[model samples]
Target: MTGRGATTVWHEENIKRTFEWSAGAIFAIPLNVSCQHFNVSKDEPVRLLAGTNMPHLMNLFHNEDFIFRNPFRFHDRFSNDADYFRHNKRLTVRSWETNLIQDVNAFPLDDYPMKGKGVRIMRFGIAGTTYGCHIQEFPVGSRSTFHRHGPGAIVTVTQGTGFAMVWREGEERRRFEIRPGSIYSPGDLMYHGHFNTGHTTMRHFAMRGRSPKYSQDRYRTPLHDMIPFEEEPPEIHKEYLEELAENGITEAVSVVKE
Candidate 1:
């Protein structure tokens, strides 16, 4: 290696050292550190999804590096202290840097009753992670069952047009319109349902924490019956037709029993 080539080699070696020193930290990127990745084999491609507390940190710090060096230092040795994390579950912060990726087609959709036709879900849960997410799809006119779960949910609509309806036990139901750019957070334990009243299929990325309450039971409670393939009562059918016409939706929807 000579001149620029030699400099590049030096830089690469320094970065390798940095990664070694920063190992076991959840997404903590120190100041002046850089990263590089390589594909050593034809085994599989990489899929990366990352979230950070940078936004919240920005609100409190004039210097980003200061926060991590102090309070976040523990993250670097988190794996070595599993007992601390298991005991302080609510206070521990989880972070990950992953290179593993798999084809969505490789995983079969769960046959649970909550899913709808043209609807498929791929759950992504990592060991020791408090947060989990899934990529979900709803084909045209498909809608999910009205259900409630323990953990708060944040959703980013990636395609098509739709709306989500949420309601608490005593509160009136609220509907929020969603599109490709929409980001919605329906808080924990709210009864909610999803509708893709579009001509094309709709997709979204959703996330929630694996909190203690989330594991007490099935995690999901249905508020309404499954979507009906057979003819609904005359009044119910009329209401469905009216909604379809009002929304300029030509696609068919399952007649869900209320």
Candidate 2:
């Protein structure tokens, strides 16, 4: 999450490749690959946040030697190609078919008005993994529509400050304060929304349970699962305005109507 670093990845036949990264960089290691990380900066410490499906795999296999020491190579997922880690900008709809993102905080995103006013988003996959992620941004004083999905999404604030409200249906809403580097995950099927109270645009990265491209689940959330602004509880907007006022923000840009 901070400083600069390099990662050395080893593949079959002793093939080795290294890539450098800085803050906001995102990449995935190929499944079962041997890799090592180095902090390139001498005086600064490098901090990184990573999520994995290893727990699920371990539970299913329940064998350390089979899970960790297996020699099977996923050649289709990764190779020793020199450009394996290069940034790919190709977009299919809102999805970027890339193995790496150089800087997610600055990556251009497409308008996603369905989620909220002034909202933009870009989904991406890494190393053909089912655990992919997306980046979303919204202007200050704006908030996203309330929505819910399955569990296992790690939401990390990449820029600006904000707060999120999470709750189950018919339950009391719980608020969580967030800023750059903050991380939180909503429970399974829990409703959640994010409000931006900072001066600059708010951006966050959500590493999700399954990639949209490769998901096989039959019970994914439907479009109707989202709660429209007009249908939301009146107290939501009132609370958002109070937050903005507390931050000394007199004008509520892109604030949804109650």
Candidate 3:
């Protein structure tokens, strides 16, 4: 997610293409393609975070050589087009179906008031993969509604600082401190929410197994899974105020009323 680098991909018919990227750049490699990454800067090391379903694939195939050295070419998923990695301006609902996002930190987002106050989000469909990704931002002193979904979501904090409360039904909640570059994943069906304590808006990117367009029954999160602000326990808000106080933030940043 940091530094500058380039990826060279060898596609079908011996076609080769190179994509250059920097911090906040998001892209996906075509399935079964031969690709190599290079760090462009000598002084700064590159850190690329990738999410894949390789574990499931490995378990299903039970063969490393076939999985890694397969000759199968997903011709429909990739092409020799010169603008394959260019940013796509088209958006379906809040989703952007593209191969690359130049800088997610600077990308505009659409309002998602259902998630929380002053929250914005943009979902991404990358490289025709069933996997999904999205960028979400919530205002400071605010928190998202507690919700639960199936596992396989890897979240990376890209801006601001805060903490996440995670738990299961009828269990004690655990607080995990979060800051820029922090990565975490909530376990299967675990209830979780984020609280932004920093002065600026908190933003995070999540790559998961379910996509907005491609519905998967195994990973679907029903509407009833979300715990509304009014339904949450009073102690949740009480502890949030306590945390804000500990951080020396006394501003009257109105939180969602319980």
TM values, all candidates: 0.51, 0.91, 0.90
Clash total of candidate 2: 1
Q: Which TM-score value belongs to model 1? A: 0.51
Which is superior by TM-score, 2 or 3?
2
Kindly report which residue stretches of model 3 are placed more than 4 angstroms away from their true locations once superposed: 87-91, 216-224, 245-258
Error in Å for residue 235 of model 1: 8.9
List model 1 lDDT by residue over 1-258, tens digit each. Answer: 001100011122332321211111122222222334443334544333354435546788867578645533223323233232123222111222221222222323442334555566655433234345556777766766665666456777767787887777778777888887577777667776677877777777676654223342323534233334343225534554466667777666544432
Top of the candidates by lDDT: 2
Estimate, for each residue in 129-209, the C-alpha lDDT of model 3 and write its tens digit: 888899998777777888888988899999999999999998898998999999999999999898888888889999975
Arrange candidates, best TM-score first: 2, 3, 1
225, model 1: CA deviation in Å? Answer: 13
How many residue pairs clash in each candidate at the backbone level? Answer: 0, 1, 0
Q: In candidate 2, where is summed lDDT lowest over 10 consecutive residues?
A: 215-224
* Candidate 1 segments exceeding 4 Å error: 1-67, 70-113, 126-128, 211-241, 245-258
Tens-place lDDT per residue, model 2, 1-258, is 669999998876876999999989988998878999999987889888898999999999999999989998898888777888984855465677777788988989987777887888988877889886899998877889899988888999999988999999888999988999999999999999988999999999998866756763422445447898888898888888897999998767655442
